[model samples]
Target: MASGFNQKNKQCSLQELAALVPDGSSIALGGSFLHRGPFAFVRELIRQEKRGLELIKQSPGYDVDILCRAGVLRRVRAGIVAMEGNFGLAPWYRRAVERREIELEEHACASLTAGLRAAAFGVPFQPCGGLHGSSLPELNGWKCLDDPYGSGQKTWVVPAIRPDFAVIQASEVDAQGNVRVHGTAHWDRIMSRAAGSVLVVAEKVVDSAVFEAQPESTLVPYFMVQNYAVVAGGAWPGSSWPAYAIDYPAVEAYMDKNSDLRAHMAAAPEAQEGNHG
Candidate 1:
């Protein structure tokens, strides 16, 4: 559980980040839709022409669509995959899955979070009794088998998801990589702790003292942060909230223009640039 930013901060690049990720590696990502995505880092991945990464997003948006369009991702485990709306309907993802261009393991949003929580807490598995009598079981590929405990209701078991790495974006971070997620945190902390390694992209790096003075504001401690870089406008063309403004017109343009997932992915900037990290 080593903390703090890597010693070679300035020396690190998105290419180095790509080295930590491998083909078909399962990745848990931060943000909900376009909210807090590690856009610059992800763009760097696309720029590097990285490929074959597997992504697990609870609520994906352009980040997932862009990667898929770049052909950098091969598989996805997600609750919802779309680029439209704030946290719903990733048209690009839906198109890709429907066209059989990628493999998808879908689950309910709450179940996805619960499973991630179990992994972060070091649990072997999470019994999803909460999904009983819901459409989630069918969507997740779980059969309506008899309950062993005879609870009189079917139970779906969601396996723990311990991702190889979790990539996130935040409003601020100290030089040591202690992240503070302002406003809605979504599941940034859960993804950070559950993954084997964590990479964060911050808008700015403040003094370590600033973090220490207000420890409660720290959402993810440096202890869990493996690699961190200061990336301004990292979540640009999306929403970064108080740190920056959302590119509403851009988002709207993306939604209005693309009818299918592949087309949307094809339209992603990263796809043309050829990076996915």
Candidate 2:
């Protein structure tokens, strides 16, 4: 149904799309630290100045960083930042956390994955051993206790995170929003199913028959997607495959030139390199 509906029938614009999410809605974003990720839509959300939106990111990117900087996000339940390779070492995100600009509930990647998976599985919560001996205990409001068997072990049981909405990008999706992903799919599958609502952006729109040809390859079914958009260069300035190239020089320029997300969001989209023709 997501594909059957057009821009007029569905919420397509970023402002209108953001309006669908009320204050205090928990959101899930799809992607790892980098590579193929969603950033354009995320930027638009921040531009609309959406408030009280809690975020759940399995592998956050500059998308998370911008939201935090714009002060639109109130709380974050994330595995790590898209930076630093280890978890999250984003310069802007780290600075905001250090300054107490936002509320944070940090967890390890495995635990974050389990949390979303639990939601997708329709479970209340999953028992996780992440953050056994780290500052996450005090920050996340989670109870970290010791073992009674004298095993000298510690564990932190993180509650499941079922999001109000999930936003993600895909290589290709049928008109009905049945998406297919290959090669380092990332947590896109879990995040899409775990949310009460799902919005997918695809580069190309194909017929449902294509998706049906390889049912197993369909990571997300149409029923789960409430809205879908065919957006080219949707993952701009970072990663887009086959269709376009990642504009890293522009991303770095945006990062260096703008101090706040507001300014960066207001700036023009980066012009692609080697377009002399």
Residue 151 in candidate 2, Cα distance off native in Å: 12
The segments of candidate 2 whose C-alpha lies over 4 angstroms from its true place after superposition are: 1-15, 84-88, 129-156, 257-277
The sequence of per-residue lDDT tens digits that candidate 2 reaches over residues 189-240 is: 8888788898876766777777767788887877677776655666766565
Instruction: Tell me the TM-score of model 2.
Output: 0.81
Candidate 2 positional error at 150, Å: 15
Top model by TM-score, which number?
Answer: 1
Where does candidate 2 have its weakest 10-residue lDDT segment?
A: 268-277
- lDDT, candidate 1, 164-228, per-residue tens: 99998888887666788788988888888788988887777777778778888888887677877
Residue 47's C-alpha lDDT in candidate 2? 59
Q: Pick the candidate with the highest lDDT.
A: 1
Candidate 1 residue spans exceeding 4 A from truth: 1-11, 86-88, 138-155, 255-277
